[model samples]
Target: MPPPALTRLSVDELVGMAGVNPWELHDRLMVGRPEQIDELANSFHRAASRVAEGDGVFGEARSCFQGAYSAQSGGDTINASPEVTKTANDFQLGASQLDTISRSLDEVAHALTTAQKTTGEYVGSLNAALSQLDAMAEAIGPGSGANEQQYNQIRAEGAGVVGSAGDLVTGVVTSYQSTLQDHMALAQANRWHSGSARRGGDPAATIPGNGTDPATVKQWWEGLSATDKQRLIDEHPDRIGNLNGVPIADRSAANELSVDRDIHRVDDVAAAHHVPSDEVLAHPELYGLDASAVTRYRNANHVLDARKTDANGGRNRTYVMAYDPLAFGGKGRAAVTIGDPDQADNIAVVVPGTGNHVNKGWSGAKDSISLYEQANKADPDHKTAVVSWMGYDAPDSPTDPRMLTPATARASGAALADDVNSLWATHDGSPQHVTVIGHSYGSTTVADAAAANQMHATDVALIGCPGTDLAHNAGDFHLDGGHVYVGDASTDPVGMLSSSPLGMPGISVAGVDGPGLGDADPAGVNYGAQRFKAEASDASPGSFVTFADHSQYYKPGSESLYNLSTIAAGHGDSLGDQGMLAVHRPSVAPVSVPNPLGGILGPDRINLPNPLDTGIGKLADPELLRGGVTDNHNH
Candidate 1:
């Protein structure tokens, strides 16, 4: 038989699209499109390096110019060379702009590399989960009968894995959209340099709600054009969001943009380090941070990034009402909401005690999320939200002398009051219940906030408090006695520290002359505030989990957590006397003359014992707060 004759293409077929050269097309198809992307990234990388080098050159020249000018010893004109100085200043500004562009390009390139790797990992996980599902199906033997219960259980678990993979994809899309929005905001800010954004005067002019009503700020904001509003966000997000009169929705939105912008800003400021290929081409999650880059990166942006995710991989919406990472010389202040408060039926704003701020924002979020989730469970039909308000520069460590006094609380209380009111300002129609919950020194903050202005809160809860500064009883808080709740663990120490006369300088000095801890212990039956039972099941890091220690307040499944959530959810049961606590009241200090040691060794130093373990000073906490009589020893 003759070799199979090859079918010859007709001239008409050859003229058609199929007649294109197969070999050349295959080569181009395989490599062309992807190469375009790679080339763009590589080119950007090269440009960034060259621009960075140019900045260093300009910086050196500026330094030399400064030195040469300084060395000249003559009159004004000779000593300061205006022409030279201007040239150097111009160079510095040019270098800065170049550096910014270079950094932005690097970020774009890293994002591309990271996306590719993530896709690969996700595809692998999807395949694995699918394989497990198949295995479980096969295990049932199809036609043969098996233990129905066991088969269902296996199938359920497999299905969960598949669902989780789907959730992962959804999360990726959400994160990308969020990141894109952040980048857009930053871009707008980069282009905005006009001085017109401050038409409302300085944000600090009236201190949000101190003297001016938030409604006024809202009115002023509403009158402005959309362009002006955008200008404010681009130029003064920190001011606009933290301002009391601003609408809640606008503030939350502005602050959200600011949070992401701050994170990227941190990256720009700390971009001096070289992100070598090892990290540049690594995980997008790392954002091209090397070992050294990682440290700088975290130091600069961890506080902002930490708020993005929850304990689980799931994303929870956190509103950044106010955030200043470098406030008070880098001590930091931030207020993060667990869910939307304006929309929630019940809202609780939690003030963390001393030794906590932006750095511990995530840990604070974990606690607030617990309260948030629990509140949801308690009131399944209504929305309940929590805000981890570390908006104050809390007294640093317990060892610091400042923590013992309410100086920080006194300084920060008015802001807290304004913030609480701001929540209501943004709410339309009638009103929603507002609860201000303070933990440890934070209780003092809450009390001070209320006493300074009308807090508008329906309830005030103090957990593990030292003392309320001045209000002798719950009646002094302006809120009804039944609405004030105090939760003091049986083992908590500083809990009662503020309740004693010694906790306050006025009390310890001359029969309550200075800021003493407890004007009157709210936990005492005489104080007339609801005292909920608090038993330690999970103490702090260094202490044992005995009923005699601290730190079980927000522990999962703990009784205190249950009661706290109950009140936060506006639960009727929380008001019932289920955990009504009764404890021995500590004796008041005898009025005495002032002494130096009295300042350091509070009344408790004189052997107050368990009796001093009073719950948070609920009503007069602000009075005690004004006294700066706070003991966040275990907060």
Candidate 2:
């Protein structure tokens, strides 16, 4: 109830009032049309029901997705399910509030209409009494005793009528006020606002676009209110899920939303084509399913399955740092972290080499977990985060000719640099000790990143590397107060392509001069990289080296893994004598060797160790099993 429309009046003035004012009462109550409120309530209810339908669809789709991962078990569902459920609840809450408002309006409207009618009846009685008084005054003349008495009676009756009408109006006003107050209190308690209301358009539209500096994005994200942040996540998750500058937890949440949406998108396509969701991924051709849809489905499931694995083993939490299931012509790209990179004291970004994609998530997940465990073991006092980044479109096969060129690495290097720079931007406190580890062709990619794309890292390790075409020496990496490290097994054919001390004619021509894939061997004496022991002891006597050595660097309990873990944990100096390898630089000049069977120009044997006896010893040739000796080992 608002204050009276008119000021306090004398009793005579009250009697003189013409009629009750229902318009003023309605205006003060602020009740809109009841029909319109009902419509709004219906809209809310429909939205709530739609959300429930979406929830069911995701549940069904998740079942099909989980089937792909486990034989008979189900994988973890989307982490966004709880948030989705809350969103549905919010919709239902809106409907409930709308209903209450509509009913309250109806009640107030009825109360005011009834009060107006009752007040009119009282006014009618006062009008009739005044008529009678006027007649009596006319009949009895000016000073008549009867006229005076009649006049007094009519005045008293009119006053009574006014009092009754006023009291009735007051009662209606009080009831309306009580109802309004209760509604307001409920709204305040629930923190209720119009769910569909927004001052502007979607908040996500205001976010900076891709390729914006991650630091700039971080600042923009921080400036938003919590409500706006949640609104953006709820409405437009894909915009920021894979964005580099966002916090890990928020990115995880946003990626989860995108994962759920991806599942729904794929399932929707399958449904449109009358293909069963469970069978759509296996027989994508049956429904004319696009490759990207299938890829998105598989990648989404991979993320869920990884989380399930961690949950079952009580391992460190897994966060999806990057998830783009539809990028790169269906090859897709993704990155997952074994620990929170922002909070960890040491962080390692592990880039996979050739033959990797989002579909092959198990390999990356295993590597990430293994590296995380090793890093934790190396420096137990400090926490380490390892991110397995399969964010590039890696060549499908190791033998692919693309491996002989820096084109692919160059194309993908900027993305790697941006990701690394983003880590520094989003770190929690003082800058973390960041290490970038690249295996096989991934090393070349890392080289390109640092050399041309402005990658910023503290330390870099390249293992089983073929060559670094862009980076001719360790200094080309431009590490911040840290050294580049190389781990090449003597027998590893791929590693030999870059670090072979023999400098064999055909090998050099094919690896360096011909395709020019890697002209700069990081393990060479002039390259200035710390050499680490990654050689395996199982080389055959007759054969130069087995291919098995190529993939053994990351094996647990091995010297190479130990050294890598130590460096990743920020304890590179603690590798001691056993882990470090001495530099090996064979003379570049060829020598005429008088072979028993034929004459050939071989590498200078004086500087090259016997591959069979010493296994191409990292130090100057050790006293060989055949009695040969060399001195002057350099690390």
Candidate 3:
């Protein structure tokens, strides 16, 4: 694998061969360890490859280290380390920290390798000179006209070759010995020198924080030992799953591992009790007897299904952000990311609304894949991460009283805010843009969260919105008016009834304030939002086309999907300034509703055009009519 070992020679002979009196301690050593140096170099290269690819956190840092070695190593100078630490959020701190040590060795290796190459070239030049002199001596025969000149040249060149070779050999020996010692000393000082101790850290008690602060959580994650990480996943998967700021890759790994453990746990229990799992699957509350265990098994299967393999047989990674069956009094909350958010250049989080449940998969994995593919098509160069974030107990049937108010949105808003904030916190600068897209009632959730928490996002999109409460205009969101986009279609009766125009039926029925009681509808012209085409056509500006209905905005071929992808790719500016599907701004201006309760202000207006005569009332249930908008219209 390497060049044949250099022939060994005694120290005195080596000194005499070099003819250098300046050399001191080198004259005393009898043995050489050139092979040890070669072996150590191999080890360094092998470790570098693993550290570079094993975890996403370390990969960026590794690249920076290699870049430094290449650019400055040749000059025999070391500058300050750039903040490559930003890339590696999971660099464990302790005696076993190897990232810095590895980098240090890399720098030394560059210097040593350069020195060795230069000395070898010197030795080669000497050998070449001696060969040339021997050839000239043979050609000349004896003393001729130019024979004397040739002989002098030959003697001088031969002597020079001998002297140069000896000096080069001495230099190689001295340099290699010192470099080897430096490398060995540094490795020994770091506990990570040995493979066994490389993964060491403190116990679980030392785990920092409650896993909220992204920076702090990353630090804590890095400080943990190998055993600690595994134990956290096994013991507190819910905490691990919902913990924001942890890398999605790690979360996916932890979740999958927990899923496996959960399956085994259920199987072990079922086997011990002679419980028929077939019967358990059929009716968990009845035949299974242990409803809690059945819930665990079901959640485990949900994760297993999510672990489906791609065409290339690679497991599609899924981050289980939140998974708790007993959350919000049994309604539960779940969030999953279809791709790695930390490494992507663009990230979009989709929140689903009405009739969402774990059984129905609030935001199904299939749905996530479709969105992911759409984003890829939108911007092929930048890696896009799409999140199916159903991190709340969403409202069920429209008949439910809770659906009429903003209570569900208010409670879930806090959780949604935390989820989005975590992304910004853990992100290592790749994703320059982040967008939050909410559909149907989910739109309302996004609005409520953004308004309450001042959510950090580059863009906020509301699709098929059903009254985003209290948002009188797009500017009411955390982002500016230009950053909020809305898509709604006229054929969608849900969109029509819910859009809070002057004296709108849906708004009045909520028992809030005016007809436009809840929030200004994005399609109502006055909401000050950008709404472009959504009807799956390549028509010009004046061409007529039907917009998609409430449930069809996300369909593959729909115009809404195209527009959404465009916006997600940060091309919203291309559409210019035009609200989609709204031919004219609301003709009748909104009149502020009375706020007799002092600071309880809202955009409640009177003397407005009632939407009842427009037949929007016929589509609504009687309960909606009974709530207060039946016949109270001023014609």
Candidate 4:
């Protein structure tokens, strides 16, 4: 009775415990293999035996037996038989064994439950580790070309195992935090150490007064040569202050081409007044123009300059003239007059040739102007206006043609023609007849202008022409309806040269016809009807027949110049000299017709034919052969 020991508990007491299960739990515990079952049964039996020994109830029962024995028989005699005693003892032992089995089963079940939970937690942690590894691997995988399929498989498996518990979440967070810290450390090291080293030395670290701004220091450091900076940093790391904060000099701006300033100065007053700087510089006559003309031109220049100086300066009108050498200017500005602006009259444009310029004296402008002035003077009854157009960039010499080709000459001529037409339009004037008198290379310039449709001159007179493209007839150049007069002197050396191979080859003259320089009279020695003689009076009487050079065509009093003026003034009938009569005839009159020479005559057998027998017919006829066709003739 000192304390009821646990061993004093009866079987009923043991069975009454809340956690104990007698059958199902005990069965599980005893259901193992015989060895394990036996060991468990033995342990249970031992525990029961101890309990029975200490139990107050069982001891009391034993004491009762002892007392009964003493009461019923004096110390030696037993109340019951041995068999019954053995049976009761056996039953008690069996009950004790069963209780032990039941207790063991309960303990086993609890242990299994705890172990399963612990294992699940451990598995979950392992899975989370794998999952974090997979996530980190994916984030740090190859950037451009990665094996996506393998990554996805790893992610899916890891996610499945990690989803089971919270411990895995903690592990993943810890791993990510460690990885982030490591990456940040690496990045900082790269930026601070590696980048600073690349700059040769850290100015902030070495120099006392160096600014803390890394960018500023870096820019200065970069300005140094790699080898030099490295040498300084390595040789004197402590003395780096000597090189710190060096400033760079700014570069100066370079000179550039500008269009806003004038490029030339004019010394001659006459040139400054009358001629543009470009022309004056190009020619020699600008220095020597007449004082009177220069005065008039200066007045005009002042008016122009004043107008241009005004607010509405751009509205001022001006004219640009470009003349070539053969464009007969003998002294200065050519005196050209246009009369009766309202009347429809004859208009003549005189085109000179090579070696023309402004500063060469008045001869450059005067000669061409005189031709026109003379034409107008010769025909006072008729309204006539003459234009001494120096509308070409003429060659400076015979060899200058090599520089001034037909194509270049044409552009200048076309521009001049356009200006001329504009002037005519502005003045309310229409030339009833227009004639172009082209001399020397000016003939070629005129042909090009006409070909480009830049000139509407009714007649084209080519004097001292080297030759045009022989392949082209007068019609091909748009001068078919108009008179195309070719004047060349027998004395002219250019007249002797072959004028075939006409079109511009890359550099050479090709397909030019020989000189058909005589008068365009089939009755005459030169049977080419379009070729006309350079008049003897206008030229030197013996010059055309003797020298055969090009200059005689423009001699004063020469019939060639006379015929040119006469035709230019719309008076073709006035040209009655031998050369003129050879070409002149009424358009309506019938002339002798010649049949084609049928035989293939040898060069020696070919004889001179009559002018009427040749291809001479009325100018009205569209189909008449004025000259040889371009394929067989020189242009």
Candidate 5:
């Protein structure tokens, strides 16, 4: 028996079927007559297949019909024959099963159609959401995050501005203080001398000469009573030298007293006496000296020697060949000279590194001259001079420790320092500031010298320094007001690792605080201080002592070189920034974004009429719709 047609039959429809009880149909069709129900399902499926193989909407409908037919195969209509009442009941069961399956198929078809519609709507929503996001992104521009490049750039610029401002302020204050101090010192000196002179009984007595013409004043002074003259001499010990030739105080005072009245101008007197204006104004005792005393003093303080010994045992030259009588017959003779020998300025000395000798290979003489030339070039305007002291016998290479020990090197440096000081004293000059430029082992020598107070250079600059165990802190090295500058190019490997265990272990020639000199920190180090960077182009090639090292003490155009020159010339404390920002500023304004999501959403998503195109929820609109469709239709 064929099963009953079940298409269009809902659960209620099945219950309303002719001569059918809902409970009985469920029990009989679902549980019995399976064969009869299968036959009816097969026939229905064949019909549906023919329809499904067609096109368009009809094909979809056919697929739905096929599902209905398959359901009917499980209906209870198999044994509908008069021979058995049980078979008849089974046939009824098959018909009931077919109806139930048909209804299920119809429901499924409806769901699929609905899902397809939903998917189309979802696609539209997704497109709208993407459009909204794009608009927002456009409005925001880009730098909303804290890590954005624009934000970082702005911060850096701000910091630079602040730092520059601070530096300017500091410079101004320092200059003001320096000027005030100079004025005070000058006032004090004048007051002390003027008061003493005024207190003396006779103005002429205080003046050290009569009011007569030059010749008469000399005769009157010569004719003074021995007791009166002796009393005057006792009062001014420096004035006693006037009876002979030596103006006891200094050349400036002596020159002033001799020619000032005759020339009627202090400047002329200064010029004639070869004395500085300050010296003349500060001290009056050295004015007017007799020839004999002057000659005696000149001989006693004369620096240059008339005779000299050749290094190779030959005739000696005037300026170059004078032998050091103090170190007679020694292995070497050290000659020291000061440039711009003036008391009001600063000083510097450039020490060459390895391969420094007197012989043809690496002569200390030649290296010293080269360094002097470089220093002059570094700062032509500064009143600074370079002292080229080749005290130690620098090695061709790092061969032996005995050849270079701090103690031994220090002894030689002390002698050299003594000579420098003596020269300064003899010339009536003193260095207000001093800097030492030491390259490689020369740095070692400088450190030792400084430790022993030999070279009282204001700042110590160590280039390609192997090691100096000086105290880490400025106080430790007794240079509280002084600075230590270390310059090591990033490419210089030796500077990166060299150290001394005996002295300041954590200090390096560079400015860092470590086992070696510490890392390069520019804030604390300036002027003759270590500058950690590449070698300046203007630096002399020999400034770098090591063969593989090209570290120069003061390159012509290098920062280190300029700093040394400025400090040595007494301008180190007052140099302002040289429009460095103009030189370093970028050529173009950088493209930047301030906010990431400010533009597109009108700053408020829910308020927009088209929420899908302008809201936070719009972010997932596309994916959300697609998901809804899949959930509705996949089953």
Candidate 6:
């Protein structure tokens, strides 16, 4: 049904309406207690945030309780996981409804305040016009001459003025009514008691499962109505925040909510344990929090802080591309981008190596920012984004047994492939020039993703790599441009793992993939990858060069960093002119030396010299080791 229009007021009626004190009404609406509505709205938002945090706490408690239950019971015999998950979902829905109410209140208050101010102005104008008309009528009283005609014309114009004022008043009234109706409907739709009904039961059931294909998930998400999408974001951010195929901006908004909830959860847990929130990190066990909870707190705060203040003196837009505080057995997973990846013409995903977790993830932020700056410098006309993707569970220590096999890397590779492909699925416009860079063990993971999982990328760079696992040659990656770049420094111990006879044994043991053992190096002469010069220090080893050189590929003002920047910015053709290519060494096969008594030696011993050795015996200046650039591991 059509809505009724506002009544048109006559001149005399407008005069009556304008009798109220315009100044008083203006003061009341603009500067008085009505202004406090903003504060009230803020309070409701804060409460909603607190409720969301409580949901996170419930999730953590569920995890802890499930662990205890599993230890006591033979298995998950009680189905505690589902029950806890549902409870958490319910709490999240409540929080969403609270946020909805807050927004509605804010909208109504703003609209009414604006209308009251406009109405006051209209009333003042109308009263002045009517008063002037009265004065002119009195000035030409009881005359039938030119003065009488002028008075009549003035009265007619005055009526027109009154009619215009009536129209203006009508607009304000109509706007006020519309605002009230819209907000009232929203409030009713998100009522506390009937949230489930308003939301149509579980929102999770309406969306694609987390394990769905990235392209399929993207299609499903795009197919949703705008209203449905926003409802999910408000009510079930946990589901879409880290979902593979969602758009970057929407994921960022959802993850930001997730971060806030995590911070709130930490505080609540601290309060429950009678400890200060700051002390939660010092003694997480006191709150029944896993070690990962501390890291989660740190990671969440890191993202929040980045939003408030610029880091490394750069004002690049920051976004939480992915966040999962309880993922990967509580080690956690997260990805922070220096610029919006979806908007950038060039994008680089920097995957770190061992000992990186959510707690120490901020270290990679510095590298990401630096790489972003350099990549921009390389191609000023095109926009670039760098992502520090700590999205996989890495070995906590170099000697950890998980490094002995390709299982972790393979699994992580699949995840990485999905993440990269998700970016391709959700990016804006034409195909982006995407580069995936990995260091040390992360290189192995990247290789697995590209070779076995069909990761979508234009270029791939591996630095300080121990091995490539199933990816033996550049062709194995199947990159868009067939460009597989390698940045292996001669003094890097880890990078030389495949070439060094001492380090090759362990890699060979861990190189098993299907029925065949994979080669241990992508930078070897026979590997067919395009090598770039990455010797940040002297080619010979020093006190710090052994392990420290492994981390220098991304260092500022270095040749390797420059070459990487060029590749990331899709300007790789200039690398040759810039003298960034490493010297090519011919592949050397192991030669057999026949012994005079061949039976005594079992067979002829085989040996070959590796051109990419770390030259452990040849030490560089100690001063260089002491005062030179330190690795990120130290930082």
Q: Indicate which candidate wins on TM-score.
A: 6
RMSD of 6: 31.7
Q: Per-residue lDDT tens digits of candidate 5, residues 277-307?
A: 4454455357554333332222222222211
| Clash numbers, per candidate | 28, 0, 3, 68, 37, 0
Model 1: number of clashes? Answer: 28
The regions of model 5 sitting more than 4 angstroms off are: 1-331, 336-344, 360-382, 403-405, 427-431, 497-547, 554-559, 574-635
All-Cα superposition RMSD per candidate: 25.6, 36.2, 33.9, 55.0, 50.7, 31.7
> Candidate 2: minimum summed lDDT over ten consecutive residues — where?
623-632
Best by lDDT: 6
What is the C-alpha lDDT profile of model 4 across 1-635, one tens digit per residue? 01112221232332243222222232332333434534664665576566456454554765687788888776733325443343333334334333434444343333333223333333333433453544554565554445565554544443433332222222222222332333333223222222233334443332212111222233344445666565554544323411212211100000000000112223344246775654544443546533433333332333223223321233322121221111222222221223322243776666676665333322223444435555665676666655555434455665442232243344345444443443344333343777777676666667656755456566777776654432144653455256667665544544322221122111222122111211122112332225443433323333223444466555555656666667777765445443353332221212222213111101112222223332222221121223321211100
Cα TM-score of candidate 2: 0.59
Q: What's each prediction's TM-score? A: 0.55, 0.59, 0.56, 0.36, 0.34, 0.59
Alpha-carbon error at 26 in model 4, in Å? 99
lDDT digits (tens) for residues 88-143 of candidate 2: 43444444444434443444344345434433433343344344444544565557
Per-residue CA lDDT of candidate 1, range 67-115, in tens? 6766784334432564444343333333333344344434434433433
> lDDT value for candidate 4?
0.40
Candidate 2's displacement at residue 7, Å, is 99
Which regions of candidate 1 deviate over 4 angstroms?
Answer: 1-211, 266-273, 276-306, 360-362, 480-482, 499-512, 538-548, 577-635
**Residue-level error in angstroms, candidate 1, position 434:** 0.7
> Model 6, range 11-50, lDDT digits (tens) per residue?
4443344442333333444443446767877887998899
On TM-score, the stronger of 2 and 4 is 2
